[model samples]
Target chain A: MRAAIPTLFILVLMILAVSLLGVFGSPLLLRVVIGAMINLVVVIGLSIFIGNSGVLSFGHASFAAIGAYSAAWFTLPITMKKIFLPSLPAFVLSTQVGLAGGAAIGAVTAAITAAVIGVVIVRLSGIAASIATLAWLAIVHSVFSNAEALTKGTSSLVGLPIETNLFVATSAALLALVVAFVFRFSRYGLMLQASREDEAAALASGIPVRQLRLFAFVVSAAVVAIAGVLKGHFLGILAVGQFYLEFTFLSLAMLVLGGMRSLSGAVVGTFAVAAIGEILRILSSGFEIFGVEVIAMPGLREIGLAIMMLLILLVRPMGITNGRELTLPWKRKAANELPITNDQIG
Target chain B: MNFALQTAIDALSVGSIYALSALGIGLLFGIMRLINFAQSEFVTIGIYILMLSAGVWFPLAALAAICVVVVLALVVERMAFRPIRTADPATLLVTSFAVSYLLQYSLVLIFGARPIGLDILPELARPIVMGSVRVPRIDIATIGATIVLLSAFALFLRKTRIGIEMRAAAVDFRMARLLGIRANRVIAVAFAMSGLLAAVVAILFAARTGVAAPTIGLELALVGFVATVIGGMGSLVGAVFGGLAVGVVTVLLQAFLPPELRAYREAFVYIVVIAVLVLRPQGLFRGAAARERV
Candidate 1:
C-alpha cells in the first residue's frame, strides 16, 4: 500500500499536465492526449499481466473488443439498434442503459469472458499459451465479424454517445495506474513473478502458478475492458476491427518498447510511442519547413513509427525505462545507482 | 467420387503450401526457439520479386526471387535475430515482430499498398478434366513440389554434412557447438532453407492467386504457424502432417458447414485449435523437439 505512492505521484503530475493541456491547447491536441490516455488504460492493463508474469499475450485486445461492443450494445439508441441491429434480442434492442451502465456491462462481460478463458489459458505457459491466446483472439473476432444481428457484422457500430471526455479518460487512467501499482506490489504479484522467473522453483516453494496467473489474467482483462468502453465512447463509434490489431500492436509495442517489466516503463512507453506516433501523424500530414510545404505522405506515420520502434529496440532491448520504476534523487538508494539487472526490475 | 476427388485435390494443394511454409517456420524454431513471424515477409518479398520480373523467363524470375529472399532471410538472421540468440522467447518473438513490421511497411513504402498482378506461371493455370472432375495443373504442381522439397530436405538432413550438423544443433545447441558444429554456419543454412521454401511458397501463392500484396505473407504465415504448432513445434514430419490436417479440416469445414456457420469458418477452425491444445499440449507429435525447460 505504501509503495503505491510513487505510482500515484507520477500519475497525478501527468494528469495535471494533461488537464492544463486540455484547458490551453487546441481541441485536436486535447483529443490526441485523451486518445493516448485511453490507450494508456489498455497498456497499463497489459502491464499488470504481461509485465508481471512475462507472458506475451497477443489476445488481450479481444477482451477490449468484448468490452467495447458491450458498451455499444447497451448504450446505443434503441432506434439505431432497430436500424442497424434489428436482429438483437428484444431486451437488448429496446433499452438505452446510458454510459455508466454500459461501462458496467462492458466490465462485467469482459471479466466473465476472461475468467472463463483464463481457466484454460492459465494451464499452459510460454509459446503454447501465446498461441492459445491468439486462437482466442481469432475466435472472438470471427464471432464479432460473423454475428451480424449482434455486432452489425463488419459494419461500424455507431451512435455511441460521446461521453468519454478528458475528465473521464484522465480519471480512468489514474485509477488504472493505481490499480496496477497496487497489484504489482501485492502478494499475488510477488508469487506470480516468482513463477515467472522459475516455474519449477516457484512450484517447489508451494506457489500455485495456475491460480495466480488466472487472477492476473482476469484482473487485467477487466481493466483493459474498461479501457475499451472508454475508447468506444471516446470515438463515438465502435468497430470490431478497431479493437483487434491496431490497439493490440500499439499497446504491446508500448509495453515492450517502454519496458515490459516496470510500471514506469508502461507509463513512459505509452507516452513515448503515442507522442511519437502523434508527431509523425502531423509530419505526415505535411508541414512547411522554412518556406516550402511538403505534401502529405499517406503511410509515412505508421512506417516511421515502426522504424522508430525498431531503432529503440535495437538500442535498448530492455525498453526505454530498462524495467526500473522511476525514482527521485532524494528518495533513490545507492543500490539504485548500480546497473539494474533483469531479475531486479519488474 | 468426383466430390471426393475435388476435395482431396483441394485439401492436398492447399495443405502442401501450408506444409512448405510450416517447414520453414519449424526449421528456425528447431534451433533458435524463435517463432520467426518475419518468415511471411520473406514470402512477400519473393512474390514481389517475381511480380517485378514477370516479363523475364519464368525460371529466371524464380531464381531472382529465391536469391533475394535468401539474402534477406540471412540478413534478418544476422542483424535482428543473432544478437538476441540467447534472449527469452518473448523478446525473440517481439524482435521478430519488429523485423516483420519493418520489412512489411518498407514494402508498402517502396511498392505502395496496391496489389500487383503477376502473369508468371500462367501455364500452371491450365486445367485437367477427367470424367466429372476438373483440377488445375497448379494443384498437381503444388503437391509435386511439396513432395519433392520434403524428400530433398529429408535426404539433406540425413546424408549431408551441414544438414547433420543442423540436426545435431537442433537437438542440443550447446552440446552440438561443443562437438564442433559451427553454430553460425548452421543457423545461416537454416535461414537459407527457410528463405528458399518461402520463395517456392511465394510462387505457388502467386500462381494460385495471380496477385501479390504485403498482407499475403501475414495471411499465410498465421496459418503456417498454426500448422507448425499442430504438427509439434520443431518436428519436420509433424509440420507436414499438421499443415495438411489444417488445410483439409479448414476446407472440409468450408465445404460442409451450414451456410450460416460457413462465414464463421475461421471461428470453427480456431475452436478446433483450442480443443487440440487443451487435449494434447505437446501437439500431435511428442517427438524430441526442445521442450521449454522447467
Candidate 2:
C-alpha cells in the first residue's frame, strides 16, 4: 500500500498533463496526445505479460483487432450495419450499444479469445513461445482479412461513434496503468517474474508457471483490447490492416525502448517515441535549424526513429529505464531488478 | 488427373521457394540463435537490383544481385547484430526487426514505395504442356534451382572445412570454440549462405510476380519464419520440411477452399503451424543440439 503512493502520484501527474494539453494545446497536439495515450495503453497491457513473464509476444495486435471489430459490431448503428456489413448475423445486425457497453463487450471477447489461445501458447517458452505468438497473429490477421461477411474482409468498417477524446483515451491509459501496476506488485506477478527469471527453477519451487502465464496473457489481451476499442471509436473507422505489422512494430518498439520490465518504462517509452516521432515529422516537412532552412528528405522520420531505437539499444540493451520502476527524485530509489542472464540464445 | 498433377507441380514450386528462404533462416538460427527478419530486406534488395539491371545481360544482373545481397547481409551483421550478439533472443529478434525496418525504409527513400513492374526473365513465365499437363517454366526452374542449391548446400556442409566448423559450432558453441572453431568465420559463412538463398528467392519471386516492391518480401519472409519454427528451430532438415509443408498446405488451401474462403488460405496454414507447436513443442524435426541447457 505504501508503494502505491508514488504510483498513484505518477498517474495523477499524467492525467493532469493530458488534461492541460486537452484544454490549452492546439487541436493537432490534442490529437497526437490522444494517439499517444492509445499507444501507451497498449504498451502497458503488453508489459503485463512480456515484462513479468520474460516472453515476447507478436500477437497482441490481433487481440486489438478483435476488440476493434467487436466494438464495431456492437456500437455501429443498426441501420448502417445492415448496409455496410449486410451479412452480419441476425443478432449482431439488430444490436446497437453505447460506447462503454460496447467496449466492455469487446474486452470480454478479447479476454476469452486470449484464454483459449493462452492454453496452447503458455506451454512453450523462450523463442518457441515467441514464434507461436507470431503464428497466432498470422492466423488472426488472415481470418479477419477473409471474413467478409463478418468483418467486411480487407475493406474499412466505418460508422463507429467518435467518442474517444483526450479524456477518454487518457482514462483508458490510466486504467491500463493501474491494472499493470497492481498485477506487477501482486503475488501472482512476483511468481510470474520468478518464472521469467528461471522457469525451471520456478517450477522446482512449486510455482504454477504455466497457469500464471495464462492469467497474464488474458489480462494483457483485455487491456490491449480496450485500446483497440478506443482506436476504433476515436477514428470512427476500423480496418484489419490497421492492426497488423506496422501497428505491432510501433507498439513493440515503444515497449522495448522504454524498458519492458516496468510499468513506468512502458509509459515513458510511449511518450518518448511519440515525441521523437512528432519532431521528426515536423523536421521532415522542413524546419529552420539555427536559421538555416532545411527540408528533410522523405522517409527521414522512419529512418531516424529506427536509428534512434538501434542506438538506444546499443547503449543500454535493457532500455531507457533499465528494468526499474520510476521514482520521485526525493524518494529513495527502487531496487534494480536482477538482470536475466539467460545466455543460451533461445 | 492432369489438373491434379498440375496443382501438385505448383505446390512443389511454391514449396521450393519457401524452402530456400527457410533454409537461410534456419542456418543463421543454428549458429547464433538469431532469426534474421532482415532476410526479407535481403530479398527485397536483391529484387531491386534486378529491377535496376533489367536491361543488362541476365547472368550479370543475377550475379550482381547475389553479390550485393551477400555483402548487405555481412554489413548488417557487423553493424547491427554483432553489437548485440550475446543479447537474449527477444532482444536479438527486436534488433533484427529494427534492421528490417531500416533496410526497408531505406529502399522506400531510394525507390518510392510503389511496386515497379519488370519481368526479369519473361521467358520463364511461359507454360509448357507435356502430355496434357501444363507447367509454368518458372515453376520448373524454381524446383530445379532448389534441388541444385540444396544439393550444393549439403555437399558444402559435408566436405568443406568452414562447413564442418559451422556444424560443430551449432552443436555446442562454447565447446566448438574450445576446440579451435572460429566463431566469427562460422557465423559469417552462415550469413553468406543465407544471403545466397535470399537472392535466389528474390529472383524467382520477382519472376513469378513481375513486380518489385519494398513489401514483396514481407509475406515470403513471414512464411519462411513460420516454416523455420514448424521445422524445428536450429534443424536444417526441419527447416526444409517445414518450408515444403507450408508451401504445399497453402497451395492446397487456395485450390480447394471455396472462393469466399480463398483469402484465408494462409491463416489455415498458420493454424496448422500453431497446432504443430502445441503438439510437439520441440518442433517436428528436433535439432541435434539439445536446446535446454538445464
Candidate 3:
C-alpha cells in the first residue's frame, strides 16, 4: 500500500472533489470547502504522529499557533508591524518576507521547539505522554496570551494577506497528505509503529524508539505549522485563542473519528465532520423546508456535532474506517490488513 | 518572613482545590485505570446547581447539589464507562474526551457563555487578622475542609470492607475480582466518592470566585490532572501533595519572579512540570500503577 497508487488515488480524488466545489460552488460554499481543506491539512499532519506512533497530542495546536504568529510577524508589512508590535526588534520591524518565506521560518521554528519538547516527552509512554502534551498546550496558551509586546496578548493581529483560496488550500492539503503517506511507510515510521504496537518487542529488536518518535514529532510539527500559516492567511488575522482548546479537540476528534491509522482515515474524518457541521450550520440559520420556515437555533450545531461524535465512539471505537487504508478496486488486498491488537496503541 | 507565610497560606488554599479534584481522579485511576477528564464537569455541574438554588438554605442547597453530582457521576459510569471497561487505554482516553465534550457543550446550551455573578461565599471572604499577616477566612476554611475530608476518606478506606476491597482492586483488579469483589459495586462506589470530592472543590471554588460559567471545570480539572500526574497517578496522598506543590510553586514564582516576566507564570510552571516528568516519570510518589515490570 505504501508504494501503490491507492493512497495517491485517494489524495487526488479528495483534491478533485474539493476543487470541483471550488469552481462551481457558491462563494459561501467555497469558503466552507477551503476551510475544511485547511483543517484536513492540520488533521493529516496530526495523524502522522498520533496514528502511526500511537501517541495522543493535545499540544500540536500550539505548533499551529507558533506558525501563525511567526508568519504574521515575518510577512505583515513593516508599517503594520510598527502599529501592532512596536517592541519588535529593529530587524523584525523592517523584515517582510512573502508567504512562502514566512511559512518556512514558522515551520523551522516550530520544528525546533518540537525537537526540544519531544526529547523529554518521548521518554514517557501511554497516558502519561498524553497528559504531558496537554501541559505543553497550557503553557503555549498562557505564554501567547501574556507575551503582550510580542503577541499582543489576545488582541487580533490584522493585516496578514487574506488570499487563501480553494486551489491554494487544496494544494496544501494534498502536499500534507503525500508527505504523511510517505512518512508512514518510511523505515523510521515503520520502526516507530512497531514500537507503538509492542514497545518491549521493538526495544528487544534494537529499534531506537525514542529517536523515531522524535523524528515523527518534529516532522508533524512542521506540517501542522504550515496549516497554521494557511489559517492565518485565510482568516486575515491571528489570535492565540483561535489555536487553543477548540481547534485542538476538533482536529483530534477528526483524526479519531475518521480512523487514526490510515491516510484515508484522516481525509474521511475531516470531510465527515466538516460535512455534518455544514449541514447543521445551515439548518441553524433558519432554513425553509417544505414551505415551512424553521427559526434559527443558536449553539445547536455544536451540540449536534458533540452528540454525533459520542455516538460514533460508542458504535465504532476504531472510527469510521477502522484504520484501514483506502484501496482501489484494481488492488488485490488493502496493504497491511494485520489485526489491530488492543495493547498496540500507546 | 511575612511574605513567605503569605505565599504558603495562599498556595495551600489554592492547592487544596487541585488536591481534592486530583484525589477523586487518583481514586478512579487506582481502581479503573481511567483519567476521567469529565470529573471537572462534575465540579461545573455542582456549581451551577448550587447557583440555581441560591435562595434556599445554604446547607440544604449544598446537600442537594452533592446528591445531584453523585447521581450524575454514577450515571456517567453506567452509561459510558461500564460498557467499554475492556477497551484499550487509548480507546478509553478518547471516550473520556467525548464524554467531556458532551457535558461541556450541554452546559453551554443550558447556561449561556457569559459569566454570571453571585456573592456565593461572603462569610469566607472575611479577613482573619493575625499579628502582622491578614488571611481570608476562606483560606482557613479551605485548608480545614481539606484536612477533614481527607481524614474521613482515609478512615473510610482503612476501616471499611469496601475500602479494603477498593485498595485490593487498585493493586490487582483481576485478582480482587477473582477473590469475589463485586466489580460493578466497587466501580460505582469509586465514582460516587470522586463525585463527592468534585462537589467539595466546586463549593470552595465558587465561594471564592462568586461566578459561574460553562467552562469553569475545565481549567480547574486541568490543574488537578496535572497535580495527579506530578503527585504520581493513583496515589491519593501523592495527589494531595502534588496539588499543594503546584499551588505553592505558582504563587512563589509570581511573588519572586521579575515583574516583567510575571505574566508568563504558567509557562514557567509548566517548564518545571516537564523537568519533573523527564526526571521522574513515575512521579514523586511511586504506587502500584507506577510499578511496571520489564
Candidate 4:
C-alpha cells in the first residue's frame, strides 16, 4: 500500500500531462513540459547524492553535457554530424539508433567517467569534494566548448531526431521517481544516509564510506546523463551553454528550493521553478514598470528568486516542506479529537 | 630570454589583479569558512558602477564604486548570511552561489548583454615601455597598488583593535564569542573589505581588457578560487603566491607552447590546480593543521 501511493501519483500526473497536451496541443507548452520532465529525472538523481549524502556535486551537469554530446555523436543525422566526428564506427554511423539507444549510451559513458573520477574525488570530504567536482565541471565544459571538431565549439548541434515527446519524458520522470523511492528505502540507502549524518560513526559501524559515496555519485551521474540524452532529443539540438554553470545554478536552486531530501520535493521544485522562470521571461519581454522594462533589469528573475530563497532560509531554513512527502491520510481521525500514541497515553 | 621576461611581466600584472580579488576571498573563507561565490559579482558591480558614474570625476567614480560594493556586501551579509549562518556550511555555500547568479543576471537586465567599456579613465590606463616590451601603465599601477594595499592590510591586521578582533574570530568563532568579540561585525567587515578589494581589481581588469561584462566575474572567480586552493584556503599570503603561480603558468604556456594548443591554457591550469590539490591539499605554505576548517 505504501509503495502504491507514489506509483499511483506519478501515473495520475502522467495521464494529466497527456490529457493536457491533447486538449491544448500547444507545441511550446509541450516542449516546456518535456524539458521539466527531463530535469526532474536528473534532479531526483541529484537528490539521492546531495540530499541523502549531504554533499553538493557541482559536476552533475557536466555528466549531462557528456551524455548529450555522446548521444548526439551516435544518433544525429550524418549531414549534421560533420563537426564532432568526421568518421564514426560503422554501427553508429550506419544505424540511426533512436532515443533509447542514445540515452543508454549516454548513461554508460557518464557512469564510466564518474567511476574514474569518483575513485579520486570520493576520497575527499566536505568542501574539498565540492571544489574537486566543480573543477571537473569546468574541465568538461571547457572540453565541450573548445573541442570544435567534435562539439562544433559553441555552435549548436542540430539534425537530431525529435524522439523525446511528452510521453517519453513523462515516462522517464516516473521511472526516476521509482528509482529514487527504491533507493531511499533500501539498506544501502540507509547506510549512505547514516554516513552522511556521521561519517566517523558510520565507518566505525562497518560501512565502506568511500565506496558508498562513489556508488551514489556514479548512479547520480548515470541518471543525469539519461536526463541529458532526453533533453537533447527533445530540443533537437545540443549546445554547451545548456549544461554549463547557468544550468548548474538553476538545478541547485531547484534542489534547494524544493527541499532536497524528498523525491516529491524534487518534482515540485522543478515544476515550480520552471513555471516561475517561464512567467518571469514572459514578463521581462512584455511587462513594464513605470516606463522601465522589467526584463531590462539585468538579473531580475534570478535576483528575485534568490531573495525568495534567502527569505525561505531565514524563516524556514529546512525548506518549504522540510523534506516531508505529500500524501493522503490512510487512516481517518475523528473531528475534535486529539490522537495519542500508546507510549504517550501510558 | 626576452620572450620569457615579457611573459613573466605579463603574468605578474595579471597575477597582481588576481591577488587583489583573492585577498577578499581568502579573508572571507578564513573567518567564516564559506566560499563567497558572489565575490566576483562584487567585481562586476564595481565595474558597472564605475561605468555608470563615469560622467563624474574618475577618482570619485572609483570611490563610489568601491563604496557601493561594500554596502552591497554588507547587505548580503545581513540579508543572506545572517539568516543562514546557523545552517549547514553547504547551505551557506549554495546561498552564496544563488546570490552570485542573482547579482549577475540583475546586472545583465539593467545593463544589457553588451560589454560596458570604461574609457573615461584613460589617464589611469596609459601604457609604459620597457626596452623591447611594452606594458600597460594600468598594469603597472595594478601591481603597485596591490603591493601598497596588501602592505597596509598587513599593518592593519598587526596593529588595529578591529584587526585583532577579526583574527580572533577567524581563529575560532565560538572562542571569539566567549572572549566578547563581535563575530558578526567582524564577518560583515570582512565581506566589505572583500568587496572593496574586488572593486580595485575590477577597475584594473577593465582598464586592461577595455570592457566589462557580466560573465567576467565567474571566470575570474574560478581563477581566484584555484589560486585560493593552491595558496591554501585561509592564508592571504598563500592566495597571493597562488595567484602569481597561476598567472605565470598561463602566460608561460601561451608563450612557450606551440600555437595550436594555446587555447588549452585553462585546461593546463586546471590540471596544475588538481595536481597541487592532490599532492598538498593544505596548500604549499599552510600547515597541515589548517586543513581542518576548509
- Per-candidate TM-score against the hidden true structure: 0.94, 0.96, 0.95, 0.90
How well does candidate 1 score on lDDT at residue B289?
A: 62
Instruction: Choose 2 or 3, whichever is better by DockQ.
Output: 2
**Candidate 3's residue-wise lDDT over A1-346, tens digit each?**
4545676787679767877876898988988998999999899999989988888888899999998898889899898899999998899998899888888888999999999988888999866787789899989999999988888898988899886778888888988988988888777777888887888889999999888989999999999999999999999989889999879888988998888877788999999999999988988788889999888766667878877876777787778888777777656254564457764211
lDDT of 1 by residue, B1-294 (tens): 888889899989988998899889988887777888899899999999998997898889989999999999999899887766776565667788878877888888788889987777777898998877999999999999999989999999999999999888777777788888888899999999999999999989988998888878986788787777878777777877888888888889988999978999998998898788788788888547637664
Provide the overall lDDT of each model, using Cα atoms, as 2-decimal numbers.
Answer: 0.84, 0.87, 0.85, 0.76
Name the lDDT value of residue A60 in candidate 4: 95
For model 4, how does the per-residue alpha-carbon lDDT over A81-190 read when each residue is reduced to its tens digit?
A: 65446666656666667789899999999999999988878877776677778888888887778888777888987878889877788878777777777776567877
Angstrom error at residue A190, model 1: 1.0
Poorly placed runs, candidate 2 (over 4 Å): A1-8, A11-19, A288-298, A328-346
lDDT of 2 by residue, B61-82 (tens): 9999999999999998888888
Model-by-model DockQ, in order = 0.48, 0.62, 0.49, 0.35
Task: Give the least accurate 10-residue stretch of model 4 chain A, judged by summed lDDT.
Answer: A337-346
Residue A58 displacement (Å), model 1: 0.9
Ranking by TM-score: 2, 3, 1, 4
Count of clashing residue pairs in every prediction: 0, 0, 0, 11
Chain B TM-score, one value per candidate, order as shown: 0.97, 0.98, 0.97, 0.94
Candidate 3 ranges beyond 4 A from true positions: A1-4, A287-294, A329-334, A344-346
Which of 1 and 4 is the better model by lDDT? 1
| Candidate 1 segments whose C-alpha is farther than 4 A from its true place | A1-4, A287-294, A329-346
List iRMS for all predictions.
Answer: 4.0, 2.2, 3.1, 7.6
